[model samples]
Target: MTTTAAPEARPAERRTAPAAPPPVRRRRRRGDALGRTGPSKYLAHAGVWLYVLLLAAPLYYLVISAFKRNTDIFNQPFSPFTPLTFDNFGLAFSQASLGTAMLNSVYVTLGAELVTLLLAIPASYALARSKGAVGRMVERVFALGFLIPGFAALVPTVLLSISLGLFHTREFLILFLPASALPLTVILLTQAMRAVPAELEESAVLDGAGPLRVLWSVYVPLSVPTLTVVAILNFLSFWNEYFFSLVIIGPDAALRTAQVALPTLSIANAAQYGVLAAGIIITLVPAYLVYAVFADKMESAVLAGALKG
Candidate 1:
């Protein structure tokens, strides 16, 4: 009976369940996204390069054509290098009176820039601090100059100069150049001046500095960035001015600026492309030189003002 009970008591083997499988991870579609993104980035770079090439092409053509013989220019339009010659430059320097014209341009530009700065600096300072309706009205009036096309004012300005006996005079041209620039200069300088801290002025005053001393010592030093921009703009405008120079200077070749002289260098039948190009290149040199020196300063000045404000 005990043996039978022991046999009956033998336990059934324990049943074991199989382990569950782990979840399958969804792989990221990174390769597909990268493939799509690659084409767009390449396309953007290509577009920028194309645009740059288009802009540079004309200047390239102009320079290439300058070196080419008249026949070669027409036959080989795409060729950049020609039998490089100084003949054109020689002719421009010797015959075009470009040297004299350069002098005239320099004189006129310097005069105009000086006059514009002299007038603009104080006006800008006043406008920056002003709070009245008069100040607002003045600003609005200055802004109107931008809206008005420069060519539209040409006739009236010429007529006014004639009436005032200012026609055919360099004095008149110098005066007029600054007058033309004043509205824009005032607007730019005023905006820049407004960005300056009031505390700077207050601190200057606390040190027993007068308004003039404070402006010269503090405001002018701080506003150098804006001033440089204004000066560069004024210089460029004055330098490249042909229309005003032509109309105001009479037929006197001696009074003509470099821009006016360059086009007239060619004879009516014999157009000298090389000489014209050389003259243009020479004219561009000063502007490029000025830009090189002042470009970083100009950016920093404006950026600093913007950040402080």
Candidate 2:
């Protein structure tokens, strides 16, 4: 009887409440200040646009000035699209010997790039693959060459050219240009070559291939994209080379490169902005064309190199 009475007792003991859930904490948003875009992000974007505009302004001026008469350029320097004229380009081509200078630039650039690649590839490969003290020493020496300004070498280079009777000669220009450009080329190509997998070389060798054979069959083929980048860089350097061309070739106006000729055309006492702009446009074309042709491959190669590193 007492047990039956106890069973009916106390509602407090009969039921229990379910547990409450833990509070949900929200994640903080990145690049946001008080749930809005940060000022730094806006500033960064603005700065990028500003930099782009800064870069484009000069090119815009050059194009506008190229089309304009001298008076228009002076009066309204910022105007977009002036009355177009082939006259400046024509004068640049004919009187300035810009056509010949362009041809000379092309010839010298091509020759120098070819020679630079020919020498740089093997040297880079050896430096990349070797592990000995001699290889380390050689690499160190090559790197040091970058420290010496090109101008510092000019006096000795000219003296040596004169002794070799190479002054004012195209052959001399070709040889000297490549020599001057080699250090940079080697540095770039070696860095690229080092990114290549050692397994590739090992596999080639295991297949009974020699070093040269492996280089030709495996390394060179894989490294084409890198080589293209190096070639482009070397071509640009040789194309824009001025001081050496100015001094070594020395007022042999006919032998001057496009770079050398451009400044020469500027009637220093009185600037011919139109003619100068045309020459600049002409010089820009080749580099632009080369980049356009190999842009995808070059980008891929550069990305790959970065990722490998």
Candidate 3:
């Protein structure tokens, strides 16, 4: 104890305090939420706007060109400020005999769509209901229809039309379009119809509902959106159909569809851009109205699905 006391108290070991942490640079968040998340969202928005511009540019140019004179169209091109005129429309109608062609297009499109739906709905229902090996085989056969290119079918189709004596007649289109559309129509509707709950179908059957009744009461109601989409797609296809109309219908004004008629204006007018554009607009009007009318069904279907989710 004396020795320890005597041992000169060793200089108190200097204890070093912990060093202060380096200051963290805090990022300023406006309203605690406006901090930059990423460049991707802004990039996506820019891409969408660019896509909009690309699509709108052609339509804008077409619309303005329809109103413009040839010289104005050539010179001003994209300018909507160019003088507008109704004369091109009149010229297009008269020169192309577009009024008659319009009527033909309506008849063909409506007829084709009706026939296609009638055949497709029943066939699709059969396919959807059947669970046999044969049914799968049949489905595969239908799928094969898609592999046959449209151009490849041209020769055989023309030959068949010639044999049937339907060549150069609009009637053949009414028949031929359905044949081409059946595969897609049947596939889509079959898939859609299959989505109907089996329990619902059983309940309906217990309530004395036959297959037809079940279809009309249950499947049809649920599949309206799909039907609308099919109708719209076929309408556009039949309306804008040119190659077959030109080939089978043989440029006959009495039988030619609107799509085929539009080109005659060019041949007759020496490529008057305004008149051609006007004809294009005229042909497009019916298609536009049809699409507008049916588009609501599609929108409702989408909203319903989102709400269910």
Candidate 2 weakest ten by summed lDDT: 10-19
> How well is each residue in 1-309 modelled by candidate 2, as lDDT tens digits?
434444433232322111223233233333343446566677877898899999999888988888878777888789765666778777777766888888888888888778887888899989988889999899888877767677888888889889999888666778888776677677777777888898988988999999899878977888776687667666767888888888887666678888888876677415679878877788788878877887654554344333421
The 10-residue segment of model 3 with minimum total lDDT is: 9-18
**lDDT assessment of candidate 3:** 0.80
Give me the candidate number with maximum TM-score: 3
Q: Which sections of candidate 3 miss by over 4 Å?
A: 1-55, 296-309
In candidate 1, which residue ranges exceed 4 Å CA deviation?
Answer: 1-50, 68-77, 267-271, 296-309
Clashes of each: 0, 0, 0
Q: Highest lDDT: which candidate?
A: 3
Estimate every model's Cα lDDT from 0 to 1: 0.75, 0.75, 0.80
lDDT tens readout by residue for model 1, 1-309 = 444444323321111111323233223342242455656877876798899999999899778866766667667778876676667666677766888888988999999999999998998888898889999998888877666556778888889889999888777888889987888788888987888899988998999999789779987888886788778777877898889888887657788888888777666216556667776777787777887887755454344333421
Clashing pairs in 2: none
- Sort order, lDDT high to low: 3, 1, 2
